[model samples]
Every structure is written in C-alpha cells, then in structure tokens.
Target chain A: MRQSKLVGTLAVLPSFVIVAGFMAFPVMFAFYISFTKTNGLTYDWRGLDNYIAIFSDPIVHQVFLNNFKFLISVPLVIFSALVCSILLFEQFKGWKFFRVIFFLPNVLSVAVIGLIFRNAFGYDGAVNQFLGLFGNEPMQFFIDSNYSILIIILALVWSGFGYQSLLLLAGLTSINPAVFEAAAIDGAGWWRRLWSITLPNIRKVLGFVFIINILYTFASLFGFVFVITAGGPGYETTTIDFLVYLRAFSSNNLGSGAALAVLLFFFIGLLTLLQNRVFKLQKDD
Target chain B: MSDSISSRLTPRAKWPIFIGMCLVAATIIYPLFFVVVTSLRSNVDYKRDPFGLPVDWTVTNYIELWDEYGVGRAFLNSLFVSTSAVAVILILATLAGYALAKLPVFGSKFFTATFVSVMLLPGPVLIIPIYLVLARLGIVGDYSGLILVYVATGLPFAIFFLTLTFRAIPDELLEAARVDGAGFFRTLWSIVGPMGASGIATLAVLQFLGTWNELIFALILVPDAQMRLLTPTLATIGKRFVSDQPLTSAGLFISALVPLLLLTFASKYIMRGLQVGLSR
Candidate 1:
C-alpha cells in the first residue's frame, strides 16, 4: 500500500513542483517585491512607498478608468453574441457557411485581429479611404485614447461575438425540444418563444458565457491593446495589464510595476469573488 | 413536431434575419480576404489599387520577410514552444489526472485545491511574477523558460479535463490489473493511457492551440528578436512597420495560417471542448 501510494505521489509531484515554482512562489514573491524597489538588478526596500506613488499618480488613475471603460465591452459583446447565436440558431439558408465565417475572428491571433482592424481604420487605410470617397476628410484610429479604445471595443465585439454565439448555439441545441414545442403550441411566436422559452432554458450556459466574458474583459484585452494602440498617444488608452507591462519593463520603474500588478491581482480577485457570489445566487434559483 | 424553433419564424422574419447574417458574414470575411490579397501584392501594387486583384501578385514580401525579418525563425520558435509545452503537459496531466481519478495519491485534496487556485489566477498577475521567476532562475529569454511557463499554466485545464475523462473508465478494470500483479504505473500506462486516448488527444490539441496563441508571456520572456514567437514577432512588425502594409500582411498571414486551418478543420473537436468546458 505504501509503495503504491509512493508511485502515485511521484506521478503527481511534477505538476505541483512546476506550479509552485513558477506560479505559487512567484505570487508571494510578487507581494514581496511589490513593497521593494527592484528591476531584476537592484533591490531596495521601500515599505509601501511604491503603492503610495502609484495611488497618487493620475496616470494610474487613468489606467484604472480605462479598464472601467473597457468593461463596457462586456455587455456589448454578450449582446452581439446573443444576436448572432440567435440568428445562427434559426438554421436559415446558408447558416452553416455563416457560422463558419463568423467564427473566423476568434481563431486568429489577436495580433492579426488588431492588424486587420488597425489597417482597416488607419487614416489612409480602407475604412477612411471608403469614407474619403463620400467627401469626408481622412480620420485616424488607434492613435488616441477615446477613438482607439472605441476601436478596441469594436475589435473585441467582432472577434468574440461569433465564438460566443457558437457557445450559445450549443446551449440552444442542448435545450429539450418539448419546451419549445409547448411554447409554440401555446401561441408564442418566434421572438416570443425566444424570450420566454429559449432564453429561460439557457440560464446556466448564459451564466457561463457571462462569467467568462466578464473575466475576459478584465484580463484578456492586452493583446488587442498591445497591437492596436500599444497604449499610445500617451498613457490614455493603457489598460491595467499593458500599463503594468509598460511600468515594469519600459518605464524602468519595477517597484511601482510590481505594485500595479499586485493591485490588479487583488482587484481581479475581488471581482471574481463578487462574480462567483452572483453566479451562485443565480444557480440557487 | 418541434423540428426547429425556425418553424415559427414567418417569411418576413427569416428574410431579414438571413440578410442580416449575410451582411455580418461579409463584414467578417472581407477584411481577412483583403489582408490575404494585400499580402500577395507589392507595396506599389497595393497603393495603386488597394481593393483590386493584386495587379502584380508576388510572393516577394513573404520571401523577403523570411530572409530579412526572422519571421520564419519565429514561426519555428512558436511551433517548438507550443509543441514542447503540450508534450510535457500531456505527460504530467495524464499521470496526475489518472492518480486523482483512481489512485489514492497522498495529498490529492491539497493538489486539487492548488491547481484550481492557480488556474484562476489572472494572467496580468502572473506575468510579472512568472517573468521574475524565470529571471531569477537565469532561464529568461530561453525556449525552455517559455516552455516551462506554458506547461505550468496549462496543467490545470488539461488535468481538469482528463480527470473527468478518466473517471468514466471503471474501477473494476484497475482492480483487475492490480490483481494481475501489475503495478499502478504499469496499469496507468497500459490500460488507462490507451483507454483515455481520446481525452488525451483532446487535451493535447487544446493545449497546443492555447499555447500557440499566447502572447504576453512569450513577448516578455523571449524578448530577443531572434527568439520571439510568431504572434509576438507579428506584433513587433505591426507596431514598428505600420506603413509597410505588404510586409505586415505577409507576417500576419503566416501567423494566422495554422490557427485558421485548425479552427476550420478541427472546429468539431474544439466546439465539443467548449461545450464540455461550459458544462464544467
């Protein structure tokens, strides 16, 4: 028994070691370095000075605000996904082709998504060129805070809606047929059935989509911003992750960077806790 | 009687919805199509007519990108990192998932908790620390360093997927193997491994795709231009050479090629995985 347990333990140990070394230990190490001044070369104890400076800085405030503005993409993306999924669920003529084409954005690298959007919206790029024929002057995107962030949100919507609609479509498929039949026989029209029967049946899947996309809005917007704006035209469009990267590497201010990373960690942790609570509440019903 | 909810839609609803979907699909497809077309054209040709068929369609941009910008090398680097990490993850997750699903591994409870927490740790939080860990270990900017992060980060999902997968295999089989004087490891490799082949393959493919599409970690750890992976390299080009649409498009096309293919061909498995993920 002991030897069997030993073998089992040995088999499972490598994963733990890698996680502890790369993930677990560094989490605490990040906390430690957050309080100190360090850039992989120099380490000096600062004792909350880093946090103090970051809190007082207006750029950090703007980054946080930028992250909040980006949160607006969450509902926008879910709505878009819902619309697409609902349409695709109809299995209309050429639905298969539409479904495949729709999901194309999700599979490509975010860098590729960013490039497509940037080039399409660049001053001399396709969108402007098309607009130019309508007698409008050239307009620039991905160059400033508001315009670039708006473009980023549009990019997010374009990329995520199809993939998520697939998830919702799967949700719609798995739903029992009898419920839809009952709703239809009772004189519910298509839109009425969608609202009453289809939407109600997919609460859990909808919840799942809602949860992941919310988290994605917080943690996963980096690649989009990095390629499209590079957090540029100053610190205006910089979300938290890009700002953290910039502070840690580009700005040569490692302590504050570590501090920013740790702060964002706590913020996300709190958000996750809150999200889980809401989800659990919904599940209880 | 309930063939589809579509049965309820009047012709009016169906026509408008179909047209709307067609417009949406056209919007999504045209930009990617434009990029591919632009990639084939020279800068001069693209400038001459951005929307037209490539007047002087040439693969010169691709050939030049390969020779000059090291994008080809980066593609190889991306492949090596993604594959290497997936290989390690498969091995570790298979053994560990099997143990958790069947074997009475000591401290299994603790291991499960740790993995769950680590899996939930946000990427922004992990980036600095993971990089610092690699830097501390003197492995930053190395392929091994990036591979290590991928394996570590990827394990939770792979193990979670496989644990559920391995559960469907009956305990009677394991007991039977044990009675045959087969040790636990031997049974795992022979009986469990083959039986769980489908799940293992799914795990491998998903992990490979996820790692291949990763950006920030590779961008930060492997900052050396020659060592950069495909997405990161493409980003550098997109940012630094925004004016050179032809060159940038060629790199974007290369970065997109494999993933686009996988998403097209293997979408069945991937969608099934997504369904499973949601159910979890």
Candidate 2:
C-alpha cells in the first residue's frame, strides 16, 4: 500500500509541477497585479485606484452591459439547440449529411467565420443582395452599431448549435430504447414521451451542456466582438474581455484590466456554481 | 394514438419548421460556398457577382495566394505549431494522466480538482499574466512561446479525459504485469499504453483542433507578420485588404480545408473526444 502511494505521488508530480508553475502562479500573479499601477512591464503598487477607475469608466459599464447582453442570449441559444436536437434526433435518411453540414462551422476558426460573415453582410454583400430580392434595402451588419451585437450573437448561435445538438443527440441515444417502447405502449404521445421520458433521462446532459455553452459563450463574446467589429461604432459591442484587452494593451492600464479580469472570474465562477448545483439537483432527483 | 398525434400535427406546422431549418442551413452554408465560388472567379467576375457561382473555374486565386501572398508559408507555420503543440500535449497529458489515475499520489485528488478548476477559467483571464511570463522568459514573440502556452492551456482537459480513460483500464491487467516481475514503467508502457490508444488518439485530435483553430493568443503573442498563424493571417487579410475579396476568400477557404478534411476523416473520434471532454 505504501509503495502504491509513492507511485501515485510520483505519477502525478509532473502534472502538479506544470499546473503550479504555469496556471496557478499566473492566476495568483494576475490577482496581485490587479492592485498595482503596472503598465504590464513595470509593477508599481497603486492600491484600489485600478478597481475604482474600472468601476467609474464609462466603457467598462458598456462592456458590462454587453456581457449582460451575451448572458441574456444564452437561454435562447440553448432552447434553439434543444429543439433542433430533438427534431434532428429522429431516424431519417439524410441525418448524417445534415449532421456533417451543421457541424462544419464549429470546426472552422471563429476568426474566419467573422471574416466570412463580415463580408457577407457588408452593404454591397450577398445578404443585402438576397434581401433585395424581397425589396428590403441592404442593412449594415458590421458598420451599424445597433445591429453589430446582433450579428455577433447570430454568428455565435450558428457556429455553436451543432456541438450542442451533438451533445444532446448523444445523450438521447444513450437512453434505453425499451423505455421509449414502454412509453409508446402506455400511449404516451410524442410530446408526452419527450417531456416525461426523454427530457428526464437527458436532463443531466442538458444541464452540463447548458453550463458549458453559457460559460463558453460568455468567454467567447470577446473574440467575436474583437474579430468582427473590434467593438466598433463607438464601443457598442465592447465586452468585458474586449475591455480588458483595451485596458491592458491599448490604454496600458494593466491594473484596471486585471481588476476587470477578477470581476469576470467571479461572475463566471458564480454561474458555474449555479450550474453545478443544478447538476447536483438533477442527479439527486 | 402516438403515431396519429405525430401524423395529425398540421402540415403547416411541419412545413414551417422544415422551411426554417432549410433557411438556417442555407444561411450557414452560403458564406462558405461564396468563399469557394469567389475564390475561383476572376476579380472582375467576382466584383460583378460575388454571390453567383463562378462562371469560369480557375485556380488563379489559389495560385496567386501561393505565389504572391505567401499564404502557403503561413499554412506551413500553422501546421508546424499545431503539430508540435499537439505532440507535446499528448505526451505530457498521457504521462500525467497515467500517474494521476494509477498512482496513489499525495494530494492526487487535490491536484486533479485544481486542474479542473483551471480548465473552467476563461482564456482571456490568463492572457496578461501569461504574456508577462513569456516576456520575462524572452519568448514573447517566439513560436515556442505560443506552442508552450497552447500546450499548457490544452493539458488540463486532455489530462482530464486521459485520466478517466486510464482509470477505466482494468486493475487486473496491471496486477498481471506486476506478477510477471515488470516494474511500474514497464507495466505502464507495455500494458496501459496499448489499451489506451483510442483515448490517446482522441485527445491528440482534439488538442490538434483546439491549437490549430486558436486565434486570440496567436494574434497577441506573435505580432510579426511572418510568424502569424492561419487564423490571424486570415483576420489580417480581411481587416487590411478588404478589397481583395477573391484572394481573402481563397485564404479563408484554404485555412478551413484542413480542419474540414480532418473532421470528415475522423468524425467518430472527434465526436467521442468532444463528448468526453465536454460532458465530464
């Protein structure tokens, strides 16, 4: 037993070293940096000024609102993913082809997708031309600040739905067919079966996917906003991550950026904790 | 009764949903298709009808990208970085996973939990800190710096999946190897390694995809035009040369082709890896 214990310690040591040296240290260092007036290269302690400035900055407030917009869209995306997964889960001839097509966008880099859509939605672009067929004028997707966030949200949903569908499909497939057969025998209709049988069985996976999709979407809003719009048209779509980047790189306010990072960490952490509670509740039920 | 209910759902209901799905699919597929079509068209033809299918199919965009823009070099740079990063991730994750799974190490549970916690942290949160560290190490603008960061970022989830797979391996196999007088390394190499091939391959493909598709770190860390990865290069092309539609589309399509082909070939493994990586 002692020998096994020693072996286990030895086995896990490399991972421990790497994680500690890289991940843990950086995280703690970042937290520490939040309190200083560092310009990323130089470290000078500045107490609560960074945190205070962040709370007072108008752009920071805009970023918070943008993040809230992103957070609000999560449930809508999840619902769409759930509904589509159910629709696609049934046995059909072209199911695999549809699956491949749906999943195509997920594999491509978000940067490329941003570029493709940016051009596609430009004033003289295809989307406008297509809308011209219906007598509507071309709408500025990338340039118009009012519509920029919506475009990002749409692109995110389009790129993401496939993976969620796949997860739900896998969860659906794992349910014993006999249970469904029994449901059918008992005269449980399609909706009834979906609610009472399928939904209940896949709830755990649903909760997992929900938490992941929300967290990932929250984190990734910055990337899309960066690549597609660059928080353009007067910082309309500037998310917390974008703000952090601006603070650190553009404004040379590393302290403020670190404070923003800490706030983002807590917001995401709280959401994740709620998600875990939901998962635990489902497991218990 | 169930069949009747499903069937009796109004034809209008079915039609609207079907049409909606088709519209969504068309919207998603249109940009990708436009890129391919525009890439094949001459500049004049592209400007005339960027949405239309190419009237004259030509490899000029691809040829020009190679000859003029040096996208081929960018492609090679991305491939090298992604491959090296994936290789390191797989080796380190495997060894670490084996240790975590098989050994009764001190604070093993704590270490595993810590790794999981790090994985949940947003990538942007780590950027400034990591950037500072890389600068200090004199690797801020270096390819190795980017690869190291990718490997580190990817290791947590890779380790997580591999640990699960390793744990699933029957303990009796290890006991049998020990009975044959094989030591720990010998048992791990000879016994556990072969059995975990699928899991290893799955993790490798995932790490490859993640590192290959990553753009943010590549953009920030490697500002030199020559060393930029495919994603950043494509972004730059779009941002800087918006007028060069055909060439930019060609570049975008070229960047996407490899991942598309890989997914087509290893869809099963990718799916399994994603399920395990995300679900657990």
Candidate 3:
C-alpha cells in the first residue's frame, strides 16, 4: 500500500516541481526583488524605492494611461462578438463557413497579424490605396502617435473578434432552444426574447468573458505593440508590459522592471477582485 | 416586438444580416488576402498597385525569406520547440492529471488548486523573474531553456483539462484493470490513457499552438539566431525589413501557414478544446 502511494506521489512530483520552480517561485521572487535593487547577479535592499521610482516615473504614468485607453476596446469587443454570435445563432446559410472564416485570424500567429496590419496600414499600403480610390490622400498611419496606438487597438480587435464570437456562440448555443420557442409562443419579439431570456441565460458566460477580456487587454496586447509599433513615436504606444521589457532589458534596470511588473500584477489582481465583486453583486441581486 | 415567429425567422429579412456578416467575415480574412497577394508581388509592383493582382508574380521574395533571411531555420526551430514542449507536457500532465483525478494521493485538492491558481499568473509578470531564474540555471539563450519555460507555461491548463477528462472515465474501467492486477502505471497506460485519447489530442493541439506562437518568452529567452522560434524571429525580421513589405509578407505567411492548416483540419477539436477551456 505504501509502495503504491509512493508511486502516486512520484507521478505528480515532476509537474509540481516545474511549476513551483518556474511559476510560483518567480512570482514570490519577483515580489521580493521589486523591493530591492538587483542586477542579475547582486542585490541590495531598497525598501520601496523601486516602487517609488515607478510612481515618480512619468513614462510609467503614460504606460498606465495607455493601458486604460486600451480597456475602451473591451466593451467594444464584447458587444461586437455578441452581435456576431447572435447572427451565427440565426443559422443563416453558410453560417459555418463564415464562422470558420472569421476564426482564421485567431489561428494565425499574433506576430503575423501584427506584421500584416503594419504592412496593410503603411502610407502606400492597401488601405490607403483603397482610400485613394475615393480621392483620399495617403496618410501616415504609424508615424503619428495617436494613429499608432489606434492601429494597435484595431489590430487586436480584428484578430480577437473571431475567437470571442466563437466563445459567445458556445454560450448562446448552450441556452435551451425551448426557452426561445416559449417566448415566441408568448408573443415576444426577437429583441424581447433575446433581452429577457437569452441574455439572462448567458450572464455567467458574459461575466467570464468580461474578466478574461480585461486580463487580455491588460497583458496580451504585447505582441501587437511589439511587432506593429515597437512602442514607437517616442514611447507613445508603450504599454506597461512594453515598458517593463524596455526598463528591464533595454535599459538594464532590473529593479525598476520588477517594480513595474509588481504594479501590473496588482492591477490585474484588483481587476479580478472587481470582477468578482461585480459578479457577486449580480448574483445577490 | 411582433410575435410572429415566422416573420422573424423567415429568410427574406435575414439577407441584410447575412450580408453584414459576410462583410465582417471579409474584414477578418482580408489581411490574409492582402498578405498572400503582396507576397507574390515585388516591392515595386506592390507599391504601384497595392490592391491589384501582382503584376510580377515573383517567387523571389519567398526564396529569399526562406534561404537568406533564415526564416526557414526559425520554422524548424518553432517546430522542434513546439513538438518538444508538447511531448513533455503530454507526459507530465498525463501523469499528474491521472494521479490527481484517479489516485488517492495526499493533498490532491491542494495540488489541483495550486495548478488552477498558477493559470492566473499573467505572462508579463513573470518575464523579469523567469529571466533571472533561467540565467541562474545558465540556460539563457538555450533551446532547452525555452522548452522548459514552454512546458511550465502549458502545464497548468493541460493538467486541469486532463484531470477533468480523466475523471470523466468510468471508474469501473480503472477498477477492472486493477482487478486484473494491473499496477498503477500499468492501469494508467493500459486503461486510462487510451480512454483519454481525444482529451490528449486536444491538449496536444492547444499546447502546440501555445508554444508555436509564443513570442514574449522566445523573445526574452532565446536571442541567438539559430535558437529563435518563428514568432520572435519574425519580429526580428519585421524590424530588419520594415519597408520591405513583400518580403515580410512572405515571412508572415510562412509563419501563419502551419497553424492555419492545423486549424483547418482539426478546427472541431480545437474549438471543442477552447469551449472546454473557456466555459468550464
């Protein structure tokens, strides 16, 4: 009996070790290092000086603000995805074909999507050429700071919409068709049936989507910003993640980078907490 | 707000919605079209007529990207890393998943909870410290280092997923194997493993996709040209060929082809996996 127990324990040990070493330990270690000045080799305790540096740093402010700006797209994505899923729910002809086509971008690498968007929005690129047909002059999309950030957000929406829709479609499909039919029998219109029945049924899924979307907007925009803008226009497009990369690697300031990362961790934690509270309130209601 | 179900469900009024959806679909797929068409054209031809079919229809850009630009090496590197990651994850996650789901291991609930919490650890937050860990172990810029990171990143979800999968197996099958005197490993290998084949395949595809398109870790860990994966290598290529649209397009298309093909063939499994990941 003890021998079998040993084997069972041994079975889980490998994965536990890897996750503990690489994931759990670093999280704790990063928190520790954030309080100290470290440069790969040595460390000196600074006692919140690194955190102080983050507050005082204007660039960090810009990064934070840029991330908040990016959050604007969360609602936009959820709404658009909801609409697409509803359209797909109607079972229109070629609906499956459209679903697959929409999801094509999600399958492609983000690096490739970023690259494609950069090329497509170049001054003499396809978009401008299309605009030129209606007599619009070629505009520099990536050169301007505002336009640069706009392009990054647009690229994310384009790449992400399909996956989000598929997820919502799954949610929508899980709702019993009988409810809709009953609403129809009760003389409810499409919008009424959707609002009073379908929406309520998928509330859990929507909440989950909201939380994941927040997490995604906060961190996963790195690939798009990395390839398309490289946080260009003098760091106008730099996000917290991008700035952390720049501070730690590019500027070789490990302490500052760790501090910034800790701050991002806190931001995500707070967002998660907020999501929980919001959902809890809804559940109570 | 009218009650006539047929009025709403009839195909006549749905054309506009359908057409609108087709346009949305076009927007999603248009960039791919642009890239492919641009890839077949020279820089000058693309610049001259961005929307038009390639006048030149040149294969030179692809040849250059593959041979001279070393994207071919990056492709091989990505394949090697993803395949290696998938192999490691499959073994480790299977063992851990089976043990957690079926075996009467101590603190199984605690271990499963730890794995689930680990999934919430954001990728960016680990960049600094994981770099430090890799450096400490002297695996910096090494393929093994990147593969290790990939396995760690993929484990939490894979294990969580496979635990659910393995738990769904009728306990009777496992009990039957034990009645036949099958050992722990034997029962897992002979009884539980084959039963979870689809689950395993789903995990493999998802893990493969994760490591294949993983950029930040590859960018941070493997700096050497020979060791770089596809996405990070493409980023480097993106920087170098900022103005060379045609060449970069070819590189992007090449990077996209594998995952696109995988999605095309196994989309049902992929979507099913995603539904499990998200909704569960």
Best by TM-score: 3
Candidate 1 CAPRI category = medium
Question: What pairs collide in candidate 2?
Answer: A8-B103, A8-B104, A8-B105, A9-B105
Alpha carbon lDDT of each predicted model: 0.83, 0.79, 0.85
lDDT of 2 by residue, A3-62 (tens): 878886777676667777678888888889999988767889988888898889888888
Per-residue error for B225 in candidate 1, Å, reads 1.8
Which tens-of-lDDT digit does each residue in B1-280 have in candidate 2?
A: 1333332234454665566666767867877887888778787887676666777888898998777776888899999999999988887887788888887677777988888888877877888888888889999889989988887788889889999999999989888888899987788788888999989988887788788889888988998987778888888777776666777788889989988888889887887786785555
Estimate the lDDT of model 3: 0.85
For each candidate, report its DockQ versus the true two-chain complex.
Answer: 0.63, 0.52, 0.66
Point to the candidate with the largest lDDT: 3
Which TM-score value belongs to model 2? 0.92
Q: Write the per-residue lDDT of candidate 3 for residues B133-174, one digit (tens) a residue.
A: 999999999989888988998999999999889999999888
Candidate 1 chain B: 10-residue stretch with minimal lDDT: B1-10
How far is B191's C-alpha from truth in model 1 (Å)? 2.9
Interface RMSD of each: 2.1, 3.1, 1.8
**Residue pairs in candidate 3 whose N, alpha carbon or C atoms collide under 3 angstroms:** none
Q: List the residue pairs that clash in candidate 1.
A: none
Candidate 1 lDDT, tens digit per residue, A1-285?
888788878888998899888888888888988998887777899999999999999999988888889888889988988999888877777887787787778778888898888887876677876887789988866555788889899898889988889888988887777777777788777778888888987777677788778778777888988988888778777888888888878766677888988988887787777767756755533
